[model samples]
Target: MNKSEILNTIHELLKNIAPEMDPTLLGQEENIREALNIDSYDALQFIVALCEKLKIDIPEQDYGKTATIKSLLTYLEKKII
Candidate 1:
């Protein structure tokens, strides 16, 4: 998938996980959990959702790379490519 596709998928996944969150309001450089008021469980669910939808594996040790939207985009872009 392309960058835009990956980002849209991420936004969709986040919206499914937290319906109240406005994905557009999430800062690329800010922590998603804090920015969206999502708890740890939701964060983990987000990761799992991405993994399932994108058909990619996100090892626990690499979860930190997804802390922000920019970081997650970078990670997914590399992985998807």
Candidate 2:
């Protein structure tokens, strides 16, 4: 999918995982931890959720690339395309 579609998917995924999260902020380029208050377990869950949904494999060492929503979407887009 494209960037916007990837972004929207990220937003939707986050909302599913955290119902109270704000959709607008989820789309920001800033750090997702700061933006969403997601801790370590949540981070792992986020990665797993994305991988499961997109049927993509995310290397353990590459977790840093998904630290932010924008970055995660970018990563997913690259993998998908």
Candidate 3:
């Protein structure tokens, strides 16, 4: 999938896992956990949800690569195909 499609999917998953997060306040480069006020557990939940929905395997070591929307987009793009 293209980055736009990937991004939209990520947004949808984030909404489900973190309804309290205000997308309006988020920047692509901002740290998702800090910007969304989510803890590590919630962050893990988001990652899990993303994997389930997208059928992508994100290794624990690569979790750090997805700290921001921009980074996550880049990581997913590479992993997806």
* Winning model by TM-score: 1
lDDT digits (tens) for residues 1-81 of candidate 1: 899999899889888877987897787899888888889898999999999999999999999999999999998998989
| Regions more than 4 Å wrong, model 2 | none
Best by lDDT: 1
Whole-model lDDT per candidate: 0.90, 0.78, 0.84
Higher-ranked by TM-score: 2 or 3: 3
- For model 2, how does the per-residue alpha-carbon lDDT over 13-77 read when each residue is reduced to its tens digit? 77776778786665456888667777788878888988887789999999989876667766788
Model 2 residue 60 lDDT score: 99
Q: Write the per-residue lDDT of candidate 3 for residues 1-81, one digit (tens) a residue.
A: 788888888888778767876654679799988877788898899989889888988989999998999899889999885
Sorted on lDDT, best first, the list reads 1, 3, 2
TM-score of each: 0.95, 0.84, 0.90
lDDT of 1 at 5: 91
Q: How do these models rank on TM-score, best leading?
A: 1, 3, 2
Error of 3 at 67 (Å): 0.4
